[model samples]
Target: MSQDRDAGARLGDSSLLRKLNLAAALGAFLKAPSLTLRELRAVIGVSRPTAEDLLAELLTEGRVEETTPPRQPSSGRGAGRPARYFRFRAESGYVSGLDIGAHKTLAVVTDLRGNTLATSRRELDPELDAAGRLSAAVETARACWVEAQLAPSDITGVACGVTGTLRAAEGVHDVGHGPVGSGLAPYSLPGFTEVDVPGALSEGLGRPVAVANDVKLAALAEHWKGAAQNHRDIVYMFAGHRAGAGVLIDGQVHQGRHGAAGEIGALPMLGWEAAVERLHARGAELARSAGTAAGREGEMVITSAARQDPESLAVLIEFAEVLARGAAVLALAVDPEMVVLGGGMSRGGPILAEPFRRELAKFTLVPLEVVTSTMGADSVALGAARLALDTVFAELLAVPGS
Candidate 1:
């Protein structure tokens, strides 16, 4: 027994055991309608006492529900007694998510199962500084919470999806059209750069908060409940005023070394100035094709030319081909199961999907499945909500049960 204890200690600490037990219990509960103590112990490979202790905590927390014992077979000879079972409650609480984009900010409130209860959206100008943008975003978030009629206390967390680089170590950078602190004047989020956007909003709303890049958030949302649900390795691109992508490995979002794995727009084209000019020239050409003459769309505009006018369809076709080049580069490196199209212009539906597929086929080592995001404008916000729920309720799912 002493040797066994020592070996167990060496193999895994109490904390590691608890996490493993939690994962086992949660997996069992999710896979089946109900589970028994004996079955949970067998699955977790933990001692009976440890399993019982974990289950007790879960039951006390109302995350799992106990049920009557199963019926035993008639005992003409000798029949074993039935065992009590447990399963997830699923309706315990909710989380909130928001996606703040260049043109629009959206919010969604969802249950633990990722079901949306209410949603709201507000238009925005990319020219607004980080502080100004946050103010508008925060207002939209508050309205969504109010419309849902949920108390601030009931919210476990709020997850936000913002465009630009998010350095967990250095914080979010390049939030709007200008410098982090200077550009946000109109909406008035003082010290936007210094404060953690998630933490600040969480404090204001009295809940925990999580944040991720907008494109990554959209990828996660689609990974969890949209077009990429069937795939483990995937790439999601949100092409607009700025183009970005989110890479997934085994269903997990990859942030890369700098938390900027998908900054596809920065890839060099003809070289620095020329490449920048080419990107803008496309935008200008799009505007002219749309009959705007001077060829200017709103601030940070990319789709205004592609989606709003038929004359610009040729330009969009070329743009889509360029997008395919980016996708091919990503695929050659990552080799994802599918590539999902998202963002405001993806609303173009199959028009964008087919062209992208054609362009992608021209290059790349492996054939790729390209599809449109099923979640639409709500993808990023919903993904944020999913991230929050995973953070909070995921713990409850671990408790073992009778």
Candidate 2:
């Protein structure tokens, strides 16, 4: 018996070692997907027991689950049991997404699976400083937690999408379009200097925070779950609370060399002063015709008029036409598969789609499909949470040999 055991030990074909390596690979597989055991073994290299042990650890921690059990042939001569496959628990933790707009800030709480559990919104005074507005946004997020019956500890991280420009080192700056800046509009709030909105938000929630442009966040959300899903390349154009855009290429956000990939709003649609004047004029016209209440009812009137009134429709078509011109330039540069229209303006789908498509077709020969976002106002918040989840998974996968 001792001789036989010795022979068995000597006959080690390294199958055990392979399995151990596979176990280590399982952790990385969980983070994303579509990894075969063979691929894992090549990368991690371990015995079967070690692999099994790693899988067991993940199972015990509830961090992984069998998404697709291994397939085995019923009549195979050497087959015993099927290999079990596992994946990360995408619903395990929750992340918070905050979208700060010109008039309000919205916060949404979602799990790793992108399921929203609660949401909150607070109207802004426009007169409030950056710190005050951020504080209000934090409070609103806490309220959302309460509404969802969740404690602050339940959150993993917070992601914020803001208007205006941001610098990596100095953080979000009230530059170009703030009260003190020469571009966009005037916003006279103090702390208008480079303020780290994300850092402040991270401190407030006691977790790390991610920051993005509001338009970019909307684009991310749409790319993930709305109109742009399955499109590897998409351009998201937002025409509300000021016009801006976000570009997605190969399923990743493209922020450009200076993190200004989609700063289309600053693309000199007109001279800065002319653009601001046009904005004010447009706002005033809408106010007089729609009672200037700036509520849903007023917006409806503006939309309704834009539809029935040829003159009004022409004006709107012109907006879409210029936007299409912008999109044409984007297509010439990026050549995305789809262009998604979002924000309050997108609520008028057909009102804008046909004209934009027609105009865009005139400029670019690329067969680009244009569509309206169905995620509506929730897109940014949803995208923020998704971004946070992605960040967490990326960190997990970065573990050595994971």
Please list the C-alpha lDDT of all candidates, in the order they appear. 0.71, 0.70
**What would the per-residue lDDT of candidate 1 be over residues 1-402, giving only the tens digit for each residue?**
432244457765656556556666666666666789988777766677877887887788776789765666776644677577998766567788988776677899987666788999998765666666677778888888789888777677688987666777656665322344553221212345566787666666666667788888889999899988889999887755555678899999888887868665554561222322455566675566666743233221335444455534555556567777778888888989889988665776665667778989989887888888788778889889878877775655554431
Give the worst 10-residue stretch by lDDT in candidate 2: 270-279
lDDT score at residue 60, model 2, on the 0-100 scale: 83
TM-score for candidate 1: 0.75
Winning candidate number (TM-score): 2
lDDT of model 1 at position 288: 67
RMSD per candidate (Å) reads: 6.4, 6.4
User: Per-candidate TM vs. native?
Assistant: 0.75, 0.79
- Give the clash total for candidate 2: 14
- Candidate 2 regions exceeding 4 Å error are 1-47, 65-87, 174-194, 269-292, 295-301, 400-402
- Scanning candidate 1 in windows of ten residues, the lowest lDDT window is 183-192
Error of 2 at 44 (Å): 7.3
- Over 1-402, each residue of candidate 2 has an lDDT whose tens digit, in order, gives 332234346656345433333344655665455344444444455444555666676668776777775455676455576545567676667788888765677899887667788999898876678788888888988998889788888887778888755667767654324334465553323464547677788888787888876777788899888988889898888765455678899988887766778765455653333433344455557667766554343244346556586545655666677777777877888989989988887787777778888988998976788888899788888888878878876665453421
